[model samples]
Target: MKILTTPDIPIATLFQNMREVYATCNVDVSWASEEVLNLPALNIVDVGTCILGSTTAEQNQLFTHRNSAGSNDIVIYFVEATDPPFNGCASHPLGMPGAVVVRTATQWTFAHEQGHVLGLNHVNDNDRLMTGNGTANITNPPPDLVASECNTMQASPITVNV
Candidate 1:
């Protein structure tokens, strides 16, 4: 995973937390980061904008980072706080998957979005990592990574980095 942050903020703790969380899945993540992006959160969206409500201009600004798949990397863009939203964007491009997380996001939000990046879909059960839309708290979810999802994640190109 490559974490992209604004020049003024730090994301090392969040990165470490994500590493710890992914450890339970036996996915060893190697990371690199760029903390010199001059852009701020408000520059991309309105002060209280929802992460998912990324406008074309905002997405274009984000795409400027060129998060392509030459390395099959999953990118994470850390921004400042937002309004009452899901915390960040968990978007999976057709060939390259990535996420956008707020500074307030917990480790679960990172892992949950990573699940989507790895081709996992949302489930109705709140006990699972892929649970949300209707009921997903910031707390612990149950132990569940179905065999199929595991296979899919294992098959991804980012597995090479593991």
Candidate 2:
């Protein structure tokens, strides 16, 4: 995995939160490296509502840093902000698997966007991690991931056996 963040944002806590979230389902989260990008133009990205299966020019530019080793590694980008009402986005250009998370996003936002990349969709329940109501709106302290969702995540091509 790879993480790209602006120089001002600290992602240590976010990474810890993400590891904890995925660990609930027995999925280990590890990264080879993290890069602190200094691109001011990309510091604040305009994702245009983060519609699934589509991406903006800024998103395309940011995702271009994805690892090209053909290992299906995931890249997480931390930006200053996205369009209003969205804290993170999982939409990427074709053949690119990555997500963009804002600096102010909830702890679960990283995991939630990753769930989308792993083929999990929004459920209406607030107690679940995949809730479309927003991670900040989750009523439960640690959101739940049902068995089916876990299965979906493990079955994604990006997942591999240890």
Candidate 3:
């Protein structure tokens, strides 16, 4: 469970929040750039400039990034506000085990996507972080998200491949 954050306009607090969550999972995360390669067994998180609507070019870039991994790799893209109103989505290379795209909204978006990165899916549990519609119940979450997810992950003790 390694996360590589790309340079984006998100607030430092947001990144801090993400770091705190990953730390609990023992997930290793680092800041990387688009030019980076050789990241075989890691999760790549990128921040893309606002590109409204779903177009071929946008889809292509996303597909390229999502498919860059060999067998066990993941990519997450963070895009700014969009028009039609989409909170977030998970996409795969062809259509399975893909990257997650989160629409920057409140504080919980990062963690929600990180949930996907950790191989966790959305949960109906209102207090869980994977709750949709921003009801993630994690406002200013504790220092460790895995510990937070313990109730959900059944104390699986995830190790973030940072």
Tell me the tens digit of each residue's lDDT in model 3 across 2-93: 22333243545555766666656565444432333333222223323322222333434444654344344445455543224444444343
lDDT of 2 by residue, 1-162 (tens): 343444233467667777887888888877666766666787677788777798999888888776443447777788777765478889887778888887778878888998898889999999999999989999986789999998898899998879
Best by lDDT: 2
Candidates 1 and 3 compared by lDDT, better number: 1
TM-score of each: 0.68, 0.87, 0.52
lDDT of model 3, residue 113: 59
Best by TM-score: 2
Candidate 3: list runs displaced more than 4 Å.
1-11, 34-61, 65-73, 81-84, 94-103, 133-140, 143-162
lDDT of the candidates, in the order given: 0.56, 0.78, 0.45
Candidates ranked by lDDT: 2, 1, 3
- Please give the lDDT score at residue 28 for candidate 3: 45
Give the Å shift of residue 145 in candidate 2. 0.3
Q: Please, what are the lDDT tens digits per residue for candidate 1 over residues 3-96?
A: 3444132455655655665566677776654533556554333323333324334544564564433547777666664334556665533444
Query: Where's the lowest-lDDT run of ten residues in candidate 1?
Result: 44-53
RMSD vs true structure, all candidates: 4.7, 2.4, 8.3
State the weakest 10-residue window (summed lDDT) of model 3.
Answer: 45-54
